[model samples]
Target: MSHTATPPPAMPPKLAEIVDEFASAPRDVVLEMLLEYSDAVPPLPETMTDRAGMEQVPECQTAFFLRVEVAADRTVTTWFDCPPEAPTTRAFAGILAEGLTGAGADQVLAVPDDLYQRMGLAQAISPLRVRGGTAILARLKRQVREQIG
Candidate 1:
């Protein structure tokens, strides 16, 4: 069953690798990969460590806070505040931060809403968790638009 809203286009190189790697992995290994991504989520920068500076995602069961910035040159950077205990939430944050970092504001905006469907994670993770992935992207793009527009 196709979960993508449209034919998925080629993503940024780093993102494409992460998605493609998961798409081909067996169900048993998907969780392992997600845990790896959770580990890859860098610690929150000292400036953004405070909850007030970051926006919390109500859609997520865990406390997932994020900040998306578009620089004067239009380079996008994303940050996350998810705990180590919440691997699933942290994995989603990590994926977004890794995928969207260095991307242009327009590129980040062009990303589809139902991206997790294309990532082949639905079978391994809960529907709510997958939706949280899309929500993170949506919120990040919104923040980017607010910053650069």
Candidate 2:
């Protein structure tokens, strides 16, 4: 009897895009890459008692993964690899904040939750799909830093 071989699962378009963007970046850049990618397409945050474990919520999705290993005083380094179906506006801030804390960052560099909510534009932060390149993601991060910080 002949058996047909099954094809491997396809990589999420968003993930492939993210890997291409920062595959060769430095640790900090990689952290930024992850945050940007996740903010664009965040995997759901996992729930847990411990903060670190709670951090796993987003990373567990087929969309993203976080790798943090650095040596710097009060330096935050968080990396997230997200699927293609995540939101990108207000959620991005929360995702980034959780990632920063999860990765041992002292604090997040984005806007505060209360302030963002006060603006009444939370729902607009829909998840972004990585279609063109990571440059867009990088640019968005810059904007977020400027507006929030």
Candidate 3:
């Protein structure tokens, strides 16, 4: 079946391009991209290396944690912690971190809630995993709102 992906919401140019890239790739290709992203997630900064600053996402079956920092100019920096065994969950973190990191708080907040659906991962990953991915984004946006407002 053919799927139509919605346009990305206002965001950084790089982030919007990443979303579009996933949306345009084949389902199997999307899965490959996810794996590639998982490897690309960067090490947490010294300030967040202590785990105390990171919030765990209980919605994911895996023990996933993340933190987002906003600069005076509203640019964002995100960090994620996840096990090697939980590549799928970690991929969500990597994708978010790679895609949205350095975006303005307003841009991150404007991202579409269903952006993950456009990745075409539903055919490869479980619904629960997909929900977890969405939850991660929701949490990111929540933290951004709380910090900047």
Candidate 4:
């Protein structure tokens, strides 16, 4: 007798609610939901800047690097994880550019809780976190490219 493989469990309903909302929603709707989810997911680093100038940056500031492994039924699971970090104007822009071009993400964003919490908005973040986010983003981008290719 032949046996079929059983699939993994789907994402939790609560988490699915959040991910599906973003996955299927319009850009503005996704952004709004992401903000709400980010807020509730704290002890988040509130130290990130509140400056309106930061808005000039692209949407990539909020995207977390992920390796999404989709099942036959289209359920998604992360095959790999990278910590949240996006620091510096130049590095942030590069992340958006590379992530978009490489990952096919029209927009890329990040959650810099670790960096922001450590640096706080008043005090500048340590050079380490700043550099770390850049490095991690670069590494994740490369990984995505290699896998896709």
Best by TM-score: 3
Q: Candidate 3, residues 1-149: lDDT per residue as tens digits?
A: 99999765587777778888888887767788888888867887676677878889899999888888888999888888998898899888888887886789988998888878876776678999999999888998899998998
Off by over 4 Å in 1: 1-10
44 in model 3: Cα distance from truth in Å?
1.5
Give the Å shift of residue 100 in candidate 2.
7.6
Q: For residues 42-102, could you state the per-residue lDDT of candidate 2 as single tens digits? A: 3334531123421222322233333333334534443444345543322343344343443
The TM-score values for the models, in the order shown, are 0.87, 0.28, 0.88, 0.28
lDDT of 4 by residue, 16-127 (tens): 3333444455544533433333222212123332331111212234443333333344332222222234224333333223223322211122222232222221133345
Q: How well does model 2 score by local distance difference test? A: 0.35
Q: Who is ahead in TM-score, 1 or 3?
A: 3
In model 4, where is the ten-residue run with the lowest total lDDT?
Answer: 102-111
Candidate 1 Cα lDDT to native: 0.81
Give all candidates' CA lDDT scores. 0.81, 0.35, 0.84, 0.33
Q: How far is candidate 4 from the true structure (C-alpha RMSD, Å)?
A: 15.4
Scored by Cα lDDT, where does model 3 land?
Answer: 0.84
* Candidate 1 local Cα displacement, residue 51, angstroms: 2.5
3 against 4, candidate with superior TM-score: 3
